[model samples]
Target: MPQSPPTISPTFRLATQIEAILYLKGQPLSLDAIADCAGCDRETAEDALIELMDDYAHRDSALEVVEMPSGYSLQLRSSFQNLIQNLVPAELGTGALRTLAAIALKNPLLQTELIELRGSSAYQQVQELVELGLVRKRRQAEGRSFWLEVTEKFHQYFEVDELSLILAQSPKHNGTAAITEEE
Candidate 1:
């Protein structure tokens, strides 16, 4: 008779299944969703989640399992943020990205100046960037227009010093026109 393969326990299988689901989703998942996807009960899924979290905490892995009100997600540890940023850039639309680049290159830019450089569509782009938490707007003292600046989130996301290095190599950074438009 052929030797039979050893069977894995239900708890171990559920934990591995939950880890795979979280990895594939690349986003937070609710306990209900995890249980449904893993074909297990909520209690089983919770046990698996806790096990996975403990596993990650005890391992030499660069990733961590986080539980938020929205759900649970696997994410890189904060210490690896600078390294990860160089590998994976933010996923912004072209218009919003261009506006972000312009803002970063010329920080503390006035709203009127941005409009002058990129046209009225900049208003919508700025709104989108602000919503994304990559840009901040403050009212100018002398005018109704706002002054736009990149936020700390932007720096953390993109590695601001790396941006400066890239910008320095670009020819556009040379002799860039001054924002002379009246506020």
Candidate 2:
């Protein structure tokens, strides 16, 4: 007899899609983010998350979906976590990383400009980056907004000497970020 592929119900498929996003992100994502990435609506994404969590609860798996104060993520089930100790590097939340990327790409970017580029949330991410020593912030001598830039720690931590490769590969976010502009 020939082998047959296992069939997945639409709900189960949606759950798997959410699973992929959570795994790839390695960070918590809200219902809206999950839905946007999954090509579904918030309600549908919520249902999918529930289904996925239920599936994990019933399976003998090392990983499980969890809800954090920030949002939803996939992580090693509590009991199995010791197996991954020191395996994963400390990570920034997705939002903070995105803000850092914007600042790095636009070296010596202005805080005001960063806010415009990354939305109001950039304020918090910038503060976090500064506290981590990956970014530096200083009062603008000529303006109210501060100046922002990546620190040596950033280059070392990310292990890249030149950003030209990254520059060549990325397009502006939604074609709106002024990453190509000459300041």
TM-score of each: 0.49, 0.48
Choose the strongest candidate by lDDT.
Answer: 2
For 1-183, candidate 2 gives per-residue lDDT tens digits of: 954423435554888878988998988999998888777779998998999999999999999998999999899888976666446534799999999988888778899998887899989899899988889998999979898989888988899776656666557443324455643
Q: What lDDT does candidate 1 reach at residue 93?
A: 79
Q: Pick by TM-score: which candidate is best?
A: 1
- Candidate 1 lDDT over residue span 17-132, tens digit each: 77878898988999998887777779988998999999999999998999989999988888899985577756777888888888877787898988988889999999989987
lDDT of 2 at 130: 94
